[model samples]
Target chain A: MMNYGIIPISHLQLAMSIILVLMAGLVSAFLKLGLLKSLIWGTIRAFIQLSLIGYLLAYIFQINHFILILLIMLLMCYIAAREATRRVNVPTQEPLLVSFLSLTASSLLVSVIVVTLIITPRPWYSAQIWIPIFGMILGNSMNGISLALDRMYNEVRSHTAEIEALLCFGASPWEAVKNSVRKALRAGMTPTINSLMVVGLVTLPGMMTGQILAGADPREAVRYQFVVMVMITASAALGCLLLIGISYRKMFTEDLALTEDMRQSHN
Target chain B: MEVFFQFTQITHQFAPNGPFIHASGSLQPGKALAVQGPSGAGKSTLLRILARLIKPTSGTVIYQDQNWQAIPPRYWRRKIHYLPQKPVMFEGTVRDNLKLPFELDLLGKEGSLDLDKAKLLLTEVGLPLASLDHDARTLSGGEAARVALVRSLLIDPEILLLDEPTAFLDTETGKKVLMYLANWLQNKKNRGLLLVSHKENNLAFFPGMQAVVIQSEGTRG
Candidate 1:
């Protein structure tokens, strides 16, 4: 029902993009907000990062080596995990490992199932199919897990008395924070659920828009979007559960005591 | 008489090198120990240590002639109940609070609410049977403390760790609660009660109770 073709941007047209950023910088300068330098640096960083990723993708797409693709995905997961850890208030030694395991476990499983079982992209490791879908799922899962971890930590810290009371009343660590974990999982899944409710109504999502621009059939694009939406929701739930489930052990000692030192150590 | 619990020089400080003396004590069955100290003397920390809720920097807690490390914390908690100074109340009826212990794994599948026993305990604490249906969140501090005491008592712990349980109650109510508590202990043999109270003079009221005074080692002078 809509135009499915898009005109490609030329190098000269891309260079002209600086004008829009400069206009934004001018507004900041005019308002004396002192954000002009930050705007310029941010624009420069985005330019460099996008350009580098574009060139990297082009090369990887040509080779299409399975190991290389796997390596890149691993790197993406590591970066995502580190980014998540940086956002959380409490510093734990296992967050990077936890994030990597949860993201890779959920996203890769869903992606593999979708690709090999569902879509069955030719050659199986098709960079175009593997990279974009996995990236979207991993990024969404990382956000959900990060928010969930933060919520769990804050809840435990704020309600130490209540949790300890439960513990004193013969609750194990799992039993003590069971309600908190449930709350965290709900917090993680809410975003994906909300997005699903208003997907095409509020605005066309980025993946669907990209597919249409690349001349994909509207029906085919819708099918892909539907699969992705479900996969993301699954990945988020799994990621939050695994992250909280694994990391919650660190909240208590081997002796199963919730000590004052344990609380301070986490903070 | 069996030494129910033994604390070997338990010490706790905010930091590893922080200036604070270690807390050392022990308790046996059918006896009450009153933990008295000035402000900031880690009296609450001492009770938490005994409750197994806190692990002192360098000490060992022995229970029933066995190392505390050998016993599971959940099981330890069942035998030794810790009632915090400020009780935490969930958003529900007083009956819901009494039903918490039955919901824990330590009690296992055999755990079930005894509404009749719960009502009897409320009556003993001078609360009407109607209090069972009252909202826990709306109950006064004194009422909450009594409810917490009843909740712990229902478990029938070997050692009951009380942290200023009567601080929020009026003089009359506090006396009634303490007498009820003392009488409750006398009824059960080999039951230990460790209370942390600022009311030093009231420690004499409980017969056969020992006074263990903890000084802060001049950390705050």
Candidate 2:
């Protein structure tokens, strides 16, 4: 017999949550913040988006098919890659390809290791476990890749003289921009590292909180949270390293000089 | 004397619709080539192309009877160095900056730093011997320019591509830099210099130096 059971919410209970949004809307209107329209639109969008995804996930869990799960994961990675490159907001060649490659490689590698070695659910590609874990990795790795890419391009742009000076000294493109790459990697990984440091003390992460709310034991949830934290950090670091490795070449010409496009100021 | 470095029909445009700037020249052993042009005429681009820093839209560069394409860019850059108008100082002391090129793995054992030669070059360029320990980034414009020159000289390139090497220096300091460069050319065999300067008077320091002028054709509609 189960010691604890998840409490189910009814349609009425869900509708009551609108009061919270209304309270926010009231504050926006009282302060003449002009955010009421956006607030209303945003609430509607979130409700619709979450509701649609909820249905999609339920169907996916029921199907429990490997190929379908993989196709969905790749689709998620493609979307994440697009979002990441969009956020970079700089001129770069083949950015979408670079982002997709980094996200897919790092997330998939980590997901496989975690699923096969640690969790080992029945049917190794079980949709319920694999899809959610892969989604979490993709989301975190996308953020890391975007931050890294943005910082790398900007750093290279600003350090044009220094990099050229190195190139004139026969430094390879890697050597010329290694310092900028270091700074960018630090920028990308800092958020994940900070979260790791403060995970238990400052906040209960989403997965752990969700498990506890669903009536799982706190200790059991904590173990899962630890796995997630470690998994996220690994994938993020891998994503940053792989992205810089592959993307740094784009900043240089085939002759190994700094690309002319990179020399012009972006801002 | 054999031509140590040469480029022919070198052409480039800064933008898609920009005016095309053309250049051609050769540098002989133990001599200098001064590249002259009006501002915005792409004189620096010519030197960059020769130094393998910029790809010329069309041209062939030959050094020591070998086409540039046949040489790996790294070795080509090592053999032909380029110094920009505005000096760039890395994060370190003058000593560290001077030793940076030698630290590259591409150089192997041949790239070992010679502290004595560096000290001598610093003093020759009118820098105080103690300036070697000073932070390179903190140096004044003239001082940094001199340090940058010394850094390039330390690499022992067969040719030196100088872009307005004296642009940041006072008249007296500028003369000192030119004097050192003249001596540098005379002291070594198979060494050449390509100097890009707006000041025609700077060319006087290198007697018998040839000149190449670049004129930018007006932009097309």
CAPRI verdict on model 2?
high
TM-score of chain A of each: 0.92, 0.97
lDDT, candidate 1, at A244: 85
Model 1 clash pairs? none
Q: What iRMS does model 2 reach?
A: 0.9
Q: What digit string (tens of lDDT, one per residue) describes model 1 on residues A151-215?
A: 87777777788888888888899898888878888888899989999999997889998888888
Over B97-191, each residue of candidate 1 has an lDDT whose tens digit, in order, gives 88987888777565687888888888888888998899999999889988988898888888888999889888888888888788877888778
Interface RMSD of each: 1.1, 0.9
Report lDDT (CA) for all predictions. 0.82, 0.89
Clashing pairs counted in every model = 0, 0
- For all the predictions, what are the DockQ values? 0.80, 0.82
lDDT of 2 by residue, B1-221 (tens): 67768888898876777788888888889999988887777888788888888787888988889999999998889889999999999989999999899888776458588899999999888999999899999999999999999999988988999999999998888988898899889998899999988777888999899999886797533
Error of 1 at B206 (Å): 1.3
